[model samples]
Target: MKITILGTGGGARAHTAKLVELGHEVFVGTRDPEATLARTAPDIMGNAPYKEWLADRPAVTLMPFGAAAAAADELVINGIDGHNAVAALSAIGDSLAGKTLIDYAVPYIYQHESEHPWPTPWGVMPKLDPCDTDSLGERIQRALPGTRVVKSFVTQEQTTVVDPKAIGAGDHTMFVAGDHDDAKLQACELLRSYGWTDILDLGPLVCARGMEMYAHMHSAIGFGLNQGFGGHFGIKVVR
Candidate 1:
């Protein structure tokens, strides 16, 4: 399978490496391939520069957003940062038409003034926009009407998302929600490929609100466990 992941951040790197390991042709989309390759310093999350990371993964191809999206066989994972994802992806709408877009972005507003701020190890916790009523998944679906959008992979760290067995022997649950049943199935197939044993279909794009809203709880759980950010954990749904 030829898969396109539209981001150069840490989370995107996790998916890229895992997909390549799974023997899938992976094309990573960035704003500018040259600029991304030119970075010398680590990203905001302190992950190594994109060039340094890609050097170790020779099988992964890096291209501008549109070209990468067009190269995908049918699946495209939107790993673009939540805030900039809609605009970035909207620019490449044509390339993504008729594809199953499994979006895992949470619409985070990184810089905001709050009377009661939620601070974390990484700084003030980012606030979610279009949060309570709408979600990033729905926004992406609206932006790309030709695409089948599925909301998933947002409730866990990207590392855990790609390697569920890293925690609890993959006993925890994964969730997928989308208006298009076929698209949700595509997402579940990828999740299974990632070794997810228990997947719950949350039903409809609107349900993305709850998934996105769970970001705070995810962080809280990490902090409660003394693991800070990028905590290795998973949430299980007990029947």
Candidate 2:
């Protein structure tokens, strides 16, 4: 399975490392591979520079966004930051045609003026755009009509997403929603490969609104637990 993850951020790295461990060929997409490799300082999230991280993961190949997407066998994970994802992915639409894009991005606008701001340890909580009526998943699907977009993995941290058993022996439930049944099945197959025992199909892509909107609540939960930033936890949908 050749997989392309279109981002160099922390979350993308998590998926990249796990997929490589699962014996899948992983290609990471970045805006500029040379620029990414030239970074000396950590990212905004304080994660180590991309070059430093890549040095340790010799198996992972890094390439420009389009090239990486074209190299995937069928699956591509859109790990690009929510705000910039649509534009970035739209540029590589041709490369992604006929592929299953499991999008885990939340459309967050990091800089905004709010009368009542929701502040976290990492600064003011970002606001979601196209939140209620539309969603990033739908936007991506609209942008790339030839691509199969499935909204998932947005409800949990990437670490927990890739290795669910680390929390509660993987008792928690993962969710997937998309208009394409076969694409959702592909997502579920990957989730199972990651050891997810329970998965709930949340119906159509419109349901992505709820998933993306859950970002605020996810942050609140982390603050409530005193975990700060990325909380180490999981949620189970009890029947």
lDDT, candidates in the order shown: 0.94, 0.95
As for candidate 1, its clashing pairs are: none
C-alpha TM-scores of all predictions: 0.98, 0.99
The residue ranges of model 2 lying beyond 4 angstroms of the native Cα positions read none
lDDT of 2: 0.95
Residue 197 CA displacement from its true place in model 2, Å: 0.5
TM-score attained by model 2: 0.99
Global lDDT for candidate 1? 0.94
Tens-digit per-residue lDDT, 1-239, candidate 1: 99999999989999999999999999999999999999999999899999999999999999999999999999999999899999999999999999999999989998799999998888899999988989999999999999999999999999999999999999999999999999999999999999999999999999999999999899899999999986789999999
The predictions' CA RMSDs to the true structure, in order, are 0.8, 0.7
Question: Where in model 1 is the C-alpha error above 4 Å?
Answer: none
- lDDT for 193 (candidate 1): 97
- In terms of lDDT, the poorest run of 10 residues in model 1 is 228-237
Per-residue CA lDDT of model 2 for 66-92, tens digit only, reads: 999999999999999999999999999
